[model samples]
Target chain A: MLESYIEQLQRVETLGELNDQVVALRDTLDVEHVVYHSVNSTGEQYAALTYSPEWVQRYLDEDYTRIDPVVQACYRRFHPIDWKRLDWTNKNVRNFHGEAIDSGIGNQGFSVPIRGPSGQFALFTVSGNASDDKWASYTQEHVRDLLLVSHFVNQKALELERGTDQVQTVSLSPRETDALTMLAMSYNRAQAADSLSISEHTLRVYIESARFKLTAMNTTHAVARALSQGLLII
Target chain B: MLRYIYADDLHRFPRLARSMFVDRAKQFHDRLRWDVTLRDDGTERDDYDDANPLYVIWEDTTGGHGGSMRFLPTTGDTMVNDHFLHLTDGVEIKSPFIWECTRFCLAPGAPAQVSAALMLGGMELGLNNHLSHSVGVFDARMVRIYARLGWGPTILGTAGQGRDATSVGLWAFEPELRPRLLSRAGITDEMSRHWYDRSFGALTPTAKPALSA
Candidate 1:
């Protein structure tokens, strides 16, 4: 099933195609739901999933992001994290969960956190109804494949973003290329810090410095420019 | 030992945030379908980080921030109280003594003792702040983790799905439970099974209220 998901990922060459393919993958997965979401280097994002429009809108309108433990925790790490490992011990977060379940998004989920040059990030998650034993076994079975697909999709999406871009820019330093590539590769600050053998503070300085040179507002935007402007390769 | 770093002090420590996949962290992007990057100027600022206490646990020798947690004292501006309006419902919340714990994280690949250190740090920070009782909504699965650390169910709490779709419960790690915990340190899991099989639990130590100016 995941092999076919990868096949679909490979066939898609455009962001629109990827979006449609993502939805198709969800339908194919035939579990309950599948979602591919991204915060691109431009900070413009795309979310293609099977979540009810009501839940999606309510979540956005209510700004549940700040209170969401899964989103909050995933942002802080580099690995593809399960929704279960997150801390959900707050009252509002619980309310958010109740609302999500009511929307038919299910309780069991696996999220693949992805990164692209210029701070591009995307999380592809599949949520469904299953026993703990079953879900654990399922995730264990497919974790590696999903991780690869996540990065592949994000890379393609970045390339897609580049194809549609109207902007242009100069070359990036090797360190800058490495930095954006790490961010592109979904290296969270700590892992990215270690990968670079630099302090996270210094990494931020490097990132912000890159942002300044690129005339970008933030790291995501910086990454977007790097990709769209051909400053960094995926 | 625990070294607390404010988000601002993310400058001094350097390792935690920098080592993090910069764009992937909460400030840049969230893993869910939704992206919550700051719109005002593309900065990430939750309510608690500014007004409530935000702490990052650091290794004193290496200065690596191994874990972090956010604390919101029971107050009007706090999200644990204000934002979570639906859950509180008609329940009574005795003000000024409770704290809402949020975003507790362990630095990836830290030593096993790190969580224990974080607990000690949290208690000390709470005691010094004049807070007495503490409340945390927990994922039902990790009830064992909290139970092992020192918290216990004070209430069943509101019926709700957890952040992860797991069952959840409300718990309290009150100061009054300290002696019973320490005196029973060597107790077997059988004896400790007052409610569940969790091995770790915090015995709330003596309450030391902060002196008023």
Candidate 2:
């Protein structure tokens, strides 16, 4: 069944077709909802969801995005995360949770955070109501499939939004590449500087330069981008 | 010793679970002033608990529960999705390998090391079960605790102030990382002897009897 879903997803060449595939995938999983949301580096956004239109409207009307922990957490992560791990301790958040449950949004959620071309950030999530053990087995059973589907969805979305592949190759100077590689290898600045026979300040310059080139959010982000893009070898 | 407990098996340690619940009522309701509903029995039970969460408990020699925490799969009922979904800006996370940890509690007067011991046990459980991550919403103050314990969790969400300020994060546990974290935290001593085993379901397994020792 998932094989068919993947084939259908691969065949989708447009956003409208992709939305239908997302809904079909959601039904195949037998979950309450499946959502694919993305924000490109340019700040343009797209979303495909199986949530009720009423709840979606309410979410927008209430401006809940500012306080949504899942979105906040996903922004910081580079891998998939479970919703149960997020912090929901505030009173307002607890109230919002109660209202969501009342609105039939399901209580369980898992999201895979995707980092796409040009710093595009996307998330794929599936939510439902089930026992912890049952949910555990279900997610365990389907995580790989879900991950594949997420990437496929993001790739299609990226293609549609950009109208061309945006994976431009980036070039880094030898020093900048070495700095990023050392940082990626878990080397502290002082150690990296010592290894490279450069001052910490010089190392920072290379790192900052590399970060700017990659448009990374920080030094770690810069390192990640370098590694993911094959611009630096560990 | 660190023992895993499930909600169904909670009945086995009636006194201990009840004590922990009362402690939670005091810690969250009274001390933290969290806006959680409390039962007339002075226990704090919520819908998530009803979902049969996996729990890790640390017990001292006097048959008392010293410290404990709760676990739930992200694929099921979790606080972050139902209530704090707004915090994620509508991102939903459902993963089998990621579980949620919550209701971390330490009985009054227990040694500080007990908290670290409880966490170590939880890490062991995840590692043994091949679980990749343990996720939770914690007080912003606990960030220091994670750093001190060398859990090295990635903060997924920024700290937010909503009465009780909290941060969401996940700790990735690889088998190789466990010993490193233990040594970094300087936790060389083994955990206490009593554990409540609920990870395997109703058939409880007790640690080796220690009378000979």
Please name the candidate that would achieve the greatest lDDT relative to the true structure: 2
Assess each prediction's global lDDT (C-alpha) against the native.
Answer: 0.54, 0.69
Query: Where is model 1 chain A poorest over a 10-residue stretch in terms of lDDT?
Result: A73-82
Interface RMSD for each of the candidates? 22.4, 16.8
lDDT of 2 by residue, A1-234 (tens): 765565466557778988998888778888989999988878988999998899899999999888887776666234365666666667677667666766776777778876554356788999887766667778888776676567667767876786635544567767778888999999999999899886664466457546645545458767876788888766
TM-score of chain A of each: 0.66, 0.68
Among all windows of ten consecutive residues in candidate 2 chain A, which has the lowest summed lDDT? A76-85
- lDDT tens digits by residue: candidate 1, A1-234: 655565466556666788787777666555588888888656797777778888899989999889976677455233355666665557677677777777788777777655343345677788887777777778776664555455556656665777745333444556657778899878888898789775554455446446544544357767876787677766
Model 2 regions more than 4 Å off: A1-234, B158-163, B181-213
Question: Docking category for candidate 2?
Answer: incorrect
Candidate 1 residue lDDT tens string, B36-151: 34534433445556442446353535654565565544322344434343443322232233455655555556565555555555554444333444555434445555567664
Q: Give the total clashing residue pairs for model 2.
A: 28
